[model samples]
Target: MDEAGLSRRGLLGLAIGAGAAGLAVGAGAGTAAGVAVGRAREREDAESAYAFFGAHQAGITTPVQDHLHFAAFDMMARTTRDDLVSLLQDWSYAASRMTQGLEVSATGAVDGSPEAPPDDTGEALGLPASGLTITFGFGPTLFETVEGEDRYAIAALRPRALERLPAFLGDDLDPAASGGDLCIQVCADDPQVAVHAIRNLSRIAFGRARIRWSQLGFGRTSRTTAAQSTPRNLFGYKDGTANILANDAASLDEHVWVAASDEPAWLAGGTYLVARKVAMLIETWDRVRLSEQDAIIGRSKGEGAPLSGGTEYTEPDFATTDANGAPAIDPNSHVRLAHPEHNGGIRILRRGYNYVDGNNELGRLAAGLFFLSFQRTPESFIRLQRSLSTDLMAEYIRHVGSGVWAIPPGARDGSFVGAGLFA
Candidate 1:
């Protein structure tokens, strides 16, 4: 431990409170040789990097990455308020470096002492940035536990809308995975890169916080930009056909980003994230007839166009009629139920993924859609979810796990995530 009683790694975390690359900003790394070495290391790994410090976090509005490692954490019992602050500081510093394609510390994996453990886990050595982004959030429990204990004594600062999500219809929710004190959403083009980020961040949390539940997701289920083609979910249907795009600033302001006028001023620039682990009964759904499936989803399986429509992007004609004079789009179809038109123009930005977690004892695949959506207020998601209670697709799926977290605004150059809460 250091003079301040901080461990070796913890001190390194504090030292880089500013940018890790700022090591040479003032003294130029002590010598020209040292400066060249630092630059060389940066150039080797800084490919496809995203800025970690921003007005809003990177992972949310940034083009969705191909892989995700979403982990929920609970603060360890009896930890002090200072412990929480320091942990966030350490996490922020480490995250800033990792997002820039640097190791968790200046002296990384191999450079540490032979007798002691390395600062970094070493799995990501020599790897490019891979467009990595790490987003952190504060779950409702972080402020006040279910039993009403304000462990950290910041309960008053908790936003009024940051309470636990209410139970919805058709929920088979697992208590073990439903709630957490904190959450981190890590995403990258390379699956290893995504996992590496969460693993390292968890290590940094150490005694202060422990992961409550985590999910590994592959094959992005939603597209965030026009450049990305619509991806299929485990149900084999093109999903997120009309999702809020990253470039729609007007829509983002209206539906996704929380406005300054909102309550709990600390969360003004941030948004709420709602996650649902919707398990698709793959074996049972496979036996479904094609025409019936089309009617269920209200879209053609091949083209993904609305049954009442022109093309994939054509607006759905909810009022259109069939030859027999019935609505072309089924009244209870997934598309119609989830559409913004039917829900008082409410919309959310989705960044979901498909996952297959091996088979169950009955020889059935344990696979599902790890649904994620960002909304300006928790009510936006709550209202939409309630509207989908009557959706026909509910027959083949079960919501096995769920959570809601208030994502704090991104850190400043020398600040930590959630620092505003303490301020």
Candidate 2:
């Protein structure tokens, strides 16, 4: 293999083994080396991540779909303020550099077991050991950037601003769902390195920018969580149910991977979509009685199972008839409305997160979803949103925010897009 490929393979090997020595020391050292070599691989992997952001300058493009949500409030201390600002600058610089020459690859796990591997492609692969996910917020800096660029460029943070739930909901925040104003979700592959990279980036940003607060998230995969499934939001429903599957190579090509088109030769192998929505009113939703809510969502709120009753992965029997001979799932039901049988079915992939807004005038009742989905075209997503907009859930949910973005494909070492596109 070429030097760049060789280095990536070596790094993957080290990363797969970094957990054995524990994440702190070995992963940290590896991350430092990765950063050192990152500059050289800029045109390959890092740059692609950056280009993904550059192309989709208007939306949130977290490295991973399953972000560990965290939210926090600003501290009153001057020292805290100074520290935050410095951290923001560091974060911006490191992330910008990391994305400069991004490359990605999939490797067999260390044990060589038949178990499936996590999808570590695109920006998700760049995450450090400790970082589970990252989320940017809407602050003065973010707003300024958005207004200046006519797009949302700010990234999210984690660990949340407050440990205790805010007073808005009248009860303590759900520990798992509580998030930071800004969050950096670490990678399961190397949590320690991810954590250090995030911290370093935060420090850089703080030193140079006027950031207020940020947080961190550290957690294992669903295989390790108490539920033995992916973490659920405050509503007790599983999130990221429609993520691109790992084992199906053909499906990956059809759904997740987009081939280059003629429009933007520079954007060959790039994909684009928009994902934005307001948080749901969970507290009020909770009061509505379980059956009613289930009907509204067309799934078990606790397990995210289809209303007809099956595991998350099982397809709902939309054609099954009830005792009365009518369709078991009503035609106007949330699920039915959102997922009709015809027109190729509800095809968009949803990779969403939850958010809590304390600034709302309605006294905050466990806000709704930070709705996000991915698809080849906006039309299908638009159809789903339109259905939701007119559905029964519309009474409680609202679309307060939105953004569009593109996800570009990976590149090999030293081979930039324009070099081939404009050559």
Candidate 3:
């Protein structure tokens, strides 16, 4: 089976042939090594848990987890503002308990009567907390109705940056998977734990809210902490190599955390989240030549070094040239275009994941990167994506889903999330 079981090339072909069906490929034999190393690190993290009530949301600055279950929900018709507030209170209480590896309620998982349904689902009964984090967000449409009417009397409280993202170039966004009035991001080292969190939260929202759409993802494509080795995407590329680290307090404050002076009082410590479901055309990408792939990404495939030269962390010499005198890094390469140097130093905290959803009707693999990022404002991502529209890599991917949410500051003890807005 060669050193990599199926060779890199062979795996790519198989991924496309089998419709990408949740296949995880490695660079030759290195994949097994990487998996072994990753699991060891995850084991340590699984044993470590974070506080649910804090200054900022846990998942934003918290160390990235191995699994994600993100869901967006819409308030039910005739739902009152008080109903929403109560739901958030319930959610916050449950979240706090779950993070500590406890049952949803004090009754315990199996302590309830035999005829009654348990408050907490038993799927994760024996599991550790697994470093789970649950973050809540309010969508643009959450502040107002489809007709632009104020629903909760908090229309004026909406941050100007919370508006729906303007349509950008090359966008083929799907309405079914797009906007939502609210979003919940559940992350954990264990897939079952993450899923369990979402399942219980959805159950609590039964009458007042309904899930609009949801996504399940594994093998996080980005690392929030610097100690992690950069993870790879389905396209066999190192993703988020230059991503902002959680330890960079200066960058986080300037680029990620919302300053009190930036907007409305309630949103002072909050940030904005932008999500896009970027579908990678594995069939086409697998057919491309290695040299072209490297040129398109502006990085060496094996080492992930900038094409301009040096190691992976080496600053790209965008000005330098090869013997022929042409620009060493392609102008439209993913790196050159998205680099902070080219974007006024604007940076976003990325926490994306690789996703494979079986096959499409055409018999091709339906797989892609579930793009997730947080910034001080929505403009950061909009500006960056606008510039990236000229990228040569656009041809190999399609943006099928999109959403923008206003992430509120974390809830303090004795209060629910978004409590300030209601005040």
For candidate 2, the TM-score is 0.51
Residue lDDT tens for model 1, 1-423: 112221122333443433344554654333444334444544533556999998899899888888899999999998999999999999999999998878999888989899988999988876678789999999999999989999998999998998888889889999897889999999987777789889999998999999999999998988999999999998889998999999999999999888899878888789999999999999989999999999999999999999998999999999999999999999999999989899999999999999888998999999999999999988998998899899999999999999999999888999999888999
Off by over 4 Å in 1: 1-46
From the highest TM-score down, the ranking of the candidates is: 3, 1, 2
Worst 10 residues of 2 by lDDT: 157-166
lDDT of each: 0.88, 0.42, 0.86
Tens-place lDDT digits, model 3, residues 252-274: 99999999888888887889999
Cα lDDT over the full model 3: 0.86
Each candidate structure's TM-score, on Cα atoms with residue i matched to residue i, is 0.89, 0.51, 0.90
Point to the candidate with the largest TM-score: 3
lDDT (0-100) at residue 216 of candidate 3?
88
